[model samples]
Target: MSVESTETNPLRALSPQDLRAHAAEALTRARERSVALTSVDDEDLVRQHSKLMSPLVWDLAHIGSQEELWLVRDVGGREALRPDIDDIYDAFQHARADRPALPLLGPEEARKYVREVREKSFDILETVPLQGRRLTEDAFAFGMITQHEQQHDETMLATHQLRKGDPVLHAPAPPSSRSGPLPAEVFVPGGAFTMGTSAEPWALDNERPAHEVAVEAFFIDTAPVTCGAYAEFLDSGGYEDPRWWSERGWAYRSEHGIDAPRFWKREQDGWWRTRFGVYEKVPAAEPVVHVSFHEAEAYAAWAGRRLPTEPEWEKAARFDPATGRSRRFPWGDEEPTPDHANLGQRHLRPAEVGAYPAGVSPLGVHQLIGDVWEWTSSGFEAYPGFAAFPYKEYSEVFFGGDYRILRGGSFGTDAAAIRGTFRNWDHPIRRQIFSGFRCARDARPSEVA
Candidate 1:
C-alpha cells in the first residue's frame, strides 16, 4: 500500500486521456487501501467498528466490485473478473459481511488486481469521445461510479479513525448562528413551477421528462427546525407518543429502537452528538440533522406542524412573482456562492440553519437552497406523463415507491449539480445524509377543514 497521487477531484472536465489516467489513479488508490486491509490481522478486520464505518476488507472489495458491476457488467459487458465477485463485495445487493472468504491476497497481489481492473475500466472509458453520442451515458455512469467510490473513501477514513478510537470531527469553524425567528414568514404566492430536469448533463432518469407542476398556497418554515426546537419535541416524549407517528413510521421507530436523532446521546449534562468518530456537545442552535423522514414527521406532528410538499418547497425557493417563473436557484439564475448557502467544503458537515439568510427565497424562507437537505411531504413518484430519461436506472427503479423528496442541497452536494428543479430521493427511514426538516401549514382558508 503506497500513496501516489491523492487527487480526489474527479468531477471536473477531463480529456479522454486525462479521464483514463484519473480512473487508473483512483483504482490504484483503492487497491492500496485494500492492501492496507490485508496487513490488519484477520480478527481486527472482522471486528465491528461502528455503524458509520464498515469492515475494512468489506469496503475495499465493495468499491472495486461495485464499479465492475455497474459500469461493466450492467452496461452489457461480460463480468471479466472473478465469478464470485458480487457475492464477496456487493454492499447493496448483499449485506452479509461474512461471505465465504476468498483466498485473501497478500497486499502486493491485491494491489495488482485493483490496478489491472482500474486500467481496464480506464481503457474502456477512452473509447467514448468527450462529445460523442454516448457522452451522456458515459458521463452519468463514470460520474456516479466515481461519486460512489469517493464516498467509500470517506467512509474508509472514518472507519480507520474509529478503529483507532479517534475523536469525532466537527466543522472547521462553527457555522454562524441566528437568534430568534426569521425577520418575517416568507409567503411564496404559489403557482405553477416546472418540476424536474430535462437537461442532459448526468441526471438520474427519475429526475427527467421535465414537467410543469401546479402548486397551491402553503406556508413554509423560514428556517430548518433547530436542535433547540427538536429538543422540545424530545422533552415532550415525542418518540414515546405513538399518536404522532404514521403506522409505518411507528413500526420503523420500534424496530430501530430510535429515540432521539441517530447520532445523539443524552449525557449527564444535556445532549452530545458523535460525528466522524468524535463526540461533542450538541449545539442547541444548529439545525437538527440526520433525522429520518419518520422522525421528522413525528416531530412535526408533536409540534403542531406538517412537512411541506415538493411544489410548496420550490415555490418558496425559485418562484419570482414579477416573471411568475422559477429561477434555477433560490437566490437567482447565478451559480451558488458561499454567502448564498453552505456546500462543497472538502470536509462534509452542515452549517447552522439560517446562516445564509440572504439566500432566502422570495417567500423569505432561509436556507431554502442549501444547508442540510429538507424533507418534504411528497413521495418519489413521476409527474403526469413522465417518460424515462436517458439514464434508465436513475428513475425507473424507484418510481411510485416509498422514497421521499428532499429539496435544497446538502453540505456535501456538488455545486454544479444543484438547482431548484433538481430532486433527490431516498427511503424514508434512511437518514445518513445531512438531512433535516422544516414545518409547513396549509395557506388556503378552505384548508381549515
Candidate 2:
C-alpha cells in the first residue's frame, strides 16, 4: 500500500490512479487491524455478550460481507459471493449481545472470507471506471467501503480495550506538552459560518449540503478538561450532588451506581484506571477520557458552565476569522501528521492537555482534532437538504434527538475517517468509547474583555 497526500480539498475529483491508491491503502489498514487480532486466542476472539461490544469474529466477517455487497455486487455488477451470509452480518439485523448466539464464522473461516472478498474487490478496482453512476462516479462506493472497514477497525480496537487479557498492543507514549501556563478558556466571537460540508467527496449524507449557521459568541475551554480537573469535581461530591446533574442523568447515575468515569477506581493512595490490560496511576495532566455525555454535563454544570452547542464547537474548530472560511481541520487544510495531532492510533492514549500547539484552532483552542471525542450539547440531526446515500441505515435511521454529537477524534481514530466536519454520535449514557468534553458558556459583555 502507498501513502497518499491528504486531499486538501476532498471535493475535488481524483484521477483513477489516485482512487486506486486510496483503496489500496484502506485495505492495508484494515488488514493490519485484523492481523493485530491474531495476538489473542480464538476463545477471546469468539467471546460474546461482552458489555456494549460484539464478538470480534463477527466484525471480521462483517467487514468482508460489506465489501462484497458494495464493491463486488453493487459497483462491479457481479453476483453475490455468498448471499446467504448477508443476513448474518447485517449490523442492523442483529444486536451485539445476540451475535454470539448465532452461528458466526470461526476465526479461520472469517479470515478466508475477508481475504477472498478483498481479492475480488481489488480486481474490480483495477477495471472499474472512476465515472458514470453516482456510486462509481468519483469512486464513492469504494471510498465508502474503505471508510466502513476502517470504522469497524476502530470498533475492534475498542473490543480489545474491553477484552480481559494481557496487553497485546503497544505504541510509544505521546510527546509531553510544550505549552506553558495559558488561559483556562478562550472567547469565540460568534458569527455565522458554514457548519457542514457540501463539497467533501466522501462526506456522509448527514454531513452533506453545507449550510450557514448563526451562533452566539461563547467562551470555551482552551483545551479538553483534564483528569485533574475532573478529579476535582469527583472530590467535591459531584456524583452525589443532584444539583449538578440533569434529572435523567441523576436517575441514570443512581440506577447504575455510577460515580467516576468508567474503568476508574480510587486506590488507597491515589486514583488509577485500566488501559488495555494494564493498570496505572491516572495521569492528571492528560485529557479525561472514557466519560459519558451525562458525566461531561454534570462536570460542566459543576463548573458553572455548559457543553458547547454543536455549532459553537464547529466554529471553534474550523472558523478562521481572517479568511472567513472554515478550514478542513482546526490547524488548516493539511492532512493530520504526527506533528499536527495525536491521531491514527500512533499513540494508545491522549497526549497531555495543552499539547499540540500546531493543531490548535485559530481561536487558540488546543487538541481540537484528536486526543478524545468531545461531547457537545446538540443531538444528532440531518443537515438541510439531507438525503440518504447508497443505503438508509448509514445515517438516516439514527437521525433524531436520541443521540448526542461528539466532535474531534480520539487517538485510536483513523485520520482518513475524521475531519473537522466529521460528526460522531452515541447515546448520552455510553462511556466505553474514548470520550471527554470541554466546558462552554454564553459570552457575556463583562466577560469578553
Candidate 3:
C-alpha cells in the first residue's frame, strides 16, 4: 500500500454504481460456483476430494471469511462478524490434507455466512471511493477479493474432478474444430516490448511495474499441442526416453510411473479420457490438459523445440508488432466474452485448437487467453521494482525457482483472474491442474519478420 507511480486512477473514473455492480456480479458468480459443485450431500462437501485440495466446506467458508476480512472489516471499518471462527478458516494455518480434521462449518452455515458477508460488502461498495493507497487504489481490494473467489472456484472445480461420485456438474461440449488446415507453428519476430501492467485497475501486485524485455525472434506452436500430437509422443515412448526430459522431470516421471497425461486410459481401440466421471474417446483436436510443467518441457524437447520463457509467452500473447505496444488481453483491452474465450466454466473441456478465432493474439496465436493454462519455461519471479500490496502471501513469499509460471488460463478460470500479463504458478510435478503447452524454437535470421 505504499506510494505508487503518478498513474491516473483506473477505478476513480468508475462510478460508485459500476463498482457496486461489479462486486455484486462477483458475489453471484461465487454463489453459482458453490451451488454447481456443492449440490450433493453434506458428507460429500466435507470429504476431501484429493490429498492436494481442501474439502468443499473449507473453501466455501474461506471465501466468505476473505470477503469479510477485506471488504467488511478493512474497507467498511466495521467490527468482525465472527472473530472466533477466524482461526477455523485460516488457510495458512492448515494444509489441505489436514483441513478435514479441523472443526468446520457445514454446508448450510457456510452458505449463510457468505450471504451475510455479501450484503455488508455491498454497503461498503456504495460509499468507498477509489482511494490512493495501493490496497484500496483503483478498487483493487475489491478486485483482489473477486479474483480470489474466482480462483477458488477453479480450485473447487479441480477438486470435483478428483471425486469418484456420479457426475453432478454438466456443460455442453465445446465447439468442434473449424474445418481447415492449421499451421503447425507460427513465427514471432520478437524485439523489445513492454511486459506487464502498471495502470490496470484490477491487475494484481505480481503483474505490476511494467518493464521492457528483448526476446530473440522465435517460432511457437500456432495453438496448444493437441491430444493427437501428445498421443503420438506417448506411443513413441516419450516417457521412457531420458534424452527428452530434464533431470528433475525424468525422476518424477519414473517415480510416478506416468506414461501419459492424467485421466487418460488405454482402451482396445484408442485412448479414452474420463471427464467428470464420463468416459469417452479422447478428442484429438482439443488441447491436451492435466499435464505438469515437466511433461510440457519434455514434450517441447521431444518436438525439437523448447518451452517459451515467460517473456516470450507474454510477447506472443500481448506484443503487437504493428503498434509496438502490449494489449491487456490477446484481442485488445476489451473484457472477455463467450466468443472471445472459453472461460468461466462455460465448457467442461477445452475447445479444439481452431476454435475462438476472435480471441487470437495479434500475431495469430490462437486461444491464448483460455482453454488450458499454457505452461512457460520461466520460474516465478518478481518484475523490476515489484512491490507487495495488501499482503505478502498474495505474491511476495512465492517468488523463487520452486514454482514455474503458467500464462493464459484454463477453461475453468474466471474472467476476473486473467489478463495477458496475469500469471499462475505451481510445482512442476503437479499435474492435477488444467495445463498444456506449445513449443518454441529459435528463429533463423531470414525467418525474422
Candidate 4:
C-alpha cells in the first residue's frame, strides 16, 4: 500500500467501513503528530518565533479545542470540555501576536488536555452514523477536523523555520526529478471549464457552488519559476525598476526596502537561503519558495508575462480535454502519493522541477499540485451562488479585495488539505508563508493550435 492513501472520496474516506477506519486512523494520526511536533522544550514551544505566527503551544491546544468544538459538540452535542479556553483558542478573537501573552496551556498540560478531547472525539466518531444532517452526510466534519489539524501542523513547521536555533526538525532530501532541460511552457486551450466544486465531499465553503468560467487560451510555465530564474530578476534590478510593479506593490517594496525573496541573502559567491535552520546555497533548479504575491507579480511582469488568473490556473490544473469532468487533483481523482508530489512534510524542501512527472496536469503543467503555493491574479471573493456552510467565519468573513488568492499547495501542505480547487488567500504583502508563482501570457490568434 502507498504511504498515503489514494483518497477516491477524499473528504469522507469513501465507504462506510472505510470511513470508520479512515476516520479512526486519521484522528489518531493527527493526535500523535500534534504531540510529536509540540515535543520541543517548553520555552521554545511557547515562544513566538515570528510576530505573524502563534506560539507552538497555542496551536497544539487550538487544534484540540477545534476538534472538540466541531466533532464533540457540534456533531455529537456533547458539553464543552473546557468552555473557558474557547476565547483563548478562538482564532478570530485574538491576533497571533497577542496569543503568547494570553493564558495558555503548557506543553505537557496541552498534551493531556488534547488527549482527553481526542478520547471523546473518538467516541463520537465510533458511534455517529455517516448519515443525516448536512455536516454528517459525507462525514464532512471529521474530514474538516483532519484537514484543520494538518493545516496547523504545517503552520507550526513554518514557525520552526523562523526560530533562531539549530534545526529541530529534519528530513531526507527530496527525491531527484533527474529531469534534464524541459519545455519552457505548455499551451492550455481556451474555453469554459468548471472552476469550483459542488460535489466534492470535503471541499470547504469558499470552494462551493461550482461555476463555469470562460478563459481565453494562454501559455503557462511548465514548471514553477525557479530560484535561478528569480536571481536574474534580482540581478537585473527588477525591484529597482518601478515599471514591473503596481503602484501599491512598489510602495510596499520601497517602504520595506525589499529587494529579494524573503529569507534570501547574498553570500559573496551567490544567493543563499536559510530553510528550517539549514543555511545552504539556493538550489538553482528547485522551484522558488517563500516569495510574496507582490514579488511574484513583479517577476511575472519582468518576464513579459502576468500571473494566471484563478480560473486560468484552475483550468490548466484540473481540466482534461478527453474527459468532461474536473479531476480532484491535477493528476487525477486519486489522493496523493510520494511519487505524485512533495507533500505532508515528507521532504524538508521542494523537489527540483520536473521531478514529479506523474504529478503533472493533463495539459502538461509540471508541479501544479505541490512544491509551492502559486500566486494567482484574482482577489478573494465568493463564487456565483455561494453560501457559507456550518459557519460563516470559515470563509465568508475573509471575502474582499484586501486578500489575494493563491492556488496549489506548498511542500509543507498536507495532502488531506489540498486539491485542484482548494483556495488559499492572504494579504498581498505577507510572504512568510510558503508561496511562489508561475507566469502566463495571452495566446495570440496565431499562437492557438
Candidate 5:
C-alpha cells in the first residue's frame, strides 16, 4: 500500500496550498543542508575517501532524483528527467564505499540538476490535485519526498562529521543552566499505552496501526548516561571484562580494539574527544555520544542496569498518564521550540544532560526527544498490521535482528523530520551516527513503595 488506509481521516487531507508551502519549506531546508555539507570548493564535495558515507555531491543529486521520481513522474504523471542516471543514484544498487568510483555527477552539474528537478516539482505541486490516489492523496508523495530529503540531510551531516577538515558548519551553543540537581533516575509507572501512531498524518509504515503495549513499572535514568559516568565504566575495566558484553559485542570489541566511544583518545592527563573537527577535553556532564549499541549495552551491564526496551523508551518519551494518550513530542503537541530540545543542527554537540527542563517528560525524564538517539534493547521489526508503503525498501527490507531500534532524535536531527513515533534503525556495530543510551531497571516492590 502506498498510503495508510485512513480514508475517513480529515487531517490527512492537507490542502493543496498547505502542501505547496510544506514542499517549499522542505526544499529550502534541503538546500541549506546541502550548503552546510559542502564547501565552496569542488574538491570537498567530490572527496569520497570515507567508506562509511556517500560523497556529498552524490547525495545532492540523489535528493533531486528522488524528488523527480516521486513528485514529477509519479504524482504529476510526467516523463523522467534523467532516466539514464537512475541506477547510479539508487541507494540499494551501490554501496557507499563504492560510490566514489562510479561516474557520479560533479558538484556544479549536481547543483544544476537538483535545481531543475526542484523547479519541476514546484510546478507540478501548483497544479496537481492534493486528493485522490494513494500517492497524490493528501499530498503524501510530496510529504514523503520532503521527509526523504530531510533524511538525506541528516546523512550528509553524518558525512560532515566523518570528513577530516576544519569545521565548515557552526551554530550557537545550546543554553546552559545551573538547574539545581535532578533525581538520578525516575520511575516510569507502567501500564498499557499505544506503542505506535495510527493518527499521525506523516508517520511512516513501520510506525503505523497504533498497538497497545503493556510494560511493568521501571526506573529509567532521568538524564542520559553521561561522559563522567561512562568514564567510570572505562576506568573499571568495563571494556576488558567479558561479563559486561554480549558474545557478539565482546567479539566486535576485541576485533576492533575498541576501549571507549569512537573519536575518543587518551591523553597524558585525561580523556579527549573530537567534535566537528575540533578536539577538546570530553565534557563530563554532556551525554556520551558516538557510541554503538554494543557500547551502550556493555556500559549498562557494567553499571548493573540494562537498556530500556523500545516500548519502554517510547512510554517514557510520549505517554501521558492524564490523557491516556501519546503527545506528538515530549513537551506536548506543539512543534519543537529551541527551549524544548537541542535539535535542527542548532548545536554541534548535545546540551548538558540536565539542561532542558522544559523538554522533560511527564515522568521527569529529561531530554527524551532530542540530544542523542537513545539505543534500546530491541531488534528492528514491523509492528502488527504493518504494511509497506510506496516502496518495500523503506522499512520492510530491514525488519530483522540484524538492526536495533533507537528512539528519540539526535542533536543533529532536523526538527521537521522528528516526532515521538519516528523510529531510527542501524546496525548494532555502527557508531558513526550520534547515539547514546539511558539505563533502565525493573522497579522492585520496595522501590516503587
Candidate 6:
C-alpha cells in the first residue's frame, strides 16, 4: 500500500506462518538472483569500487552464510551445513580488500548451501511460535540478518551499475538546492512523548519496549547540514576548536589528520567529492553524506547549534495515537515517492536538504525520514524497559559507552525497513555509511520581565 504504512507495518510483527511465507519468498528471490551471477564475468567479479564494500562474490557468500548462521545453526537445525562458514564468509572478520579470496564455493556448492539454509530457516519459521521469549530473540536475529542481506542485495545492484557506468538519467535525484538557500527552519513544540517503537512483534534489542521521554520545545534545521554549510565551518577553522570536539573525536581527527570530508579533495578552484566511483565537484545544496559524528558535532558547534537528542528527534517524527502511539511514518501512512523522500536507491546519493517539503514531519521537520541517517546527541543505549531477546549480541554488546544513536533513514534504507519508529545505531568514530546531522536547540524559559 502506502510507503510509510508498509514501513510501519513490516513483517516484523508477523506470525510464524507469516515468517515462513516471507522466508520462502526471500529464498526464491535469493536463488533466482544467484543465477544472475552467471552473467557477471571474472572482470566484473574482481572489480573493486568502494573501499568499504567487498566484491560481488563475497557478498553472495556472506548472504548465504548469514542465513546459515542465524536460521539453521541458531534456530530449527542445531547443525551448521557449512562448518567452515565463519572462516569462509565472515564479512565482519576481514576487510574484503585486505583478506585473500575466500574458499570460493562453486555455483552449485553455493546454491546447495543457500537451499539448505533456506529450508532449515523455513522449518523454524513454521514451528516456532513468534511470540514467546526464545522466539522473540531468534526472530529479531533473523530479522536483522534478513534486512542486512537485503541491504547487500541493493549494494550488489549498485556495484553492477558502477561496473557498467550506467547513464545518470536512469538514476535521477531529488530536486537540487543549486537555485538558492533552503528553507530556514522547522519547529517542533515538544513535550512528554514516547521514544522508540516496540508494540510490534520484532524490534531490535536497541529499540525495545517503547519508553516515555520528555523534550523541551526547539527548532531543528528543516534539512540535514549540507556540504556547502560544512565547508564554511572548515574554512573558518572549525576543526581547531577544542570546545567543539569530544576527547575521542579530537584524537581521531588528529591521528587521521582528517581536514575535510572523507570523500573530498581540495582543488585549486573548489572542493570535490567522489560519487559512486566517479569524482564530481561538490554541490553546495546537497545534504552532506559520508561524515563522521565528530565532523557533524564540529560543524554544529561552529554554527552555535547542537545535534538533537534521540528523544527530541523521535518526538519530531512519530505522532502519538490516543489509544497508543501509532504514526507509521513522518509523512503519514503513505509509501515514499520521489516527491516525499530520497530513498531506496532512487538517487543512491544524498539530495539537497528541504527538497521534499511534502515529506515534512508533523512538527514541520524536513527529511527526518530519509536523505541520510541523521546523527543524534544520544548514545546507543537501551530504553527504560529494555530486555535482551535471543540475540544478545545485537545491541547489548556495545552498551553503556561507545555506540551512538542515529534516527531517521538514509538513501540506502529499504522502503519497507524505514519508519518513524525505526532506530539505527553505530559507533561514533565510524563514517563508512551515508550519514549526516541536523541542528537542534535547547529552548529557554521566558523571563518574568
Give TM per candidate. Answer: 0.75, 0.96, 0.96, 0.96, 0.95, 0.79
Whole-model Cα lDDT per candidate? 0.66, 0.86, 0.86, 0.87, 0.85, 0.69
Q: Put down candidate 2 lDDT per residue, 1-449, tens digits, no spaces.
A: 00122225743555678878876776778678666765578888899626589998899899999999999998888988889899999998998988998889999998888888888888998999877788877667877887787788778878888877678889899999988876999989867887787667777788876788899889999999999999999999999999999999999999999989988999997789999888989999999999999999999999999999999999999888877788789999877888889887788899998679889999899998889999999999989898999789888899995899999989988887788889999999998899999999998878655
> Global lDDT for candidate 4?
0.87
lDDT rank order: 4, 3, 2, 5, 6, 1
User: Please, what are the lDDT tens digits per residue for candidate 4 over residues 66-165?
Assistant: 9989988988899988998999999999999999899999888898888888889888988887897889877789989998998898888888889997
Candidate 2 lDDT (Cα, 0 to 1) = 0.86
- In terms of lDDT, the best-performing candidate is 4
Off by over 4 Å in 6: 1-56, 72-80, 86-112, 115-142, 151-170, 175-182, 240-243, 320-326, 333-339, 447-449
TM-score, prediction 5: 0.95
Minimal lDDT window, size 10, model 5: 1-10
Residue-pair clash count for candidate 3: 0
The deviation in Å at residue 105 for candidate 5 is 0.5
- How many clashing pairs in candidate 6? 6
Model 2: residue 4 alpha-carbon error in angstroms: 22
Pairs with steric clashes in candidate 2: none
Which candidate do you rate higher for TM-score, 2 or 5? 2
Worst 10 residues of 6 by lDDT: 1-10
Q: Summarize candidate 5's per-residue lDDT along 174-212 as a digit string, tens digits.
A: 777446677899888868887787776667888887887
Which of 1 and 3 is ahead in lDDT? 3
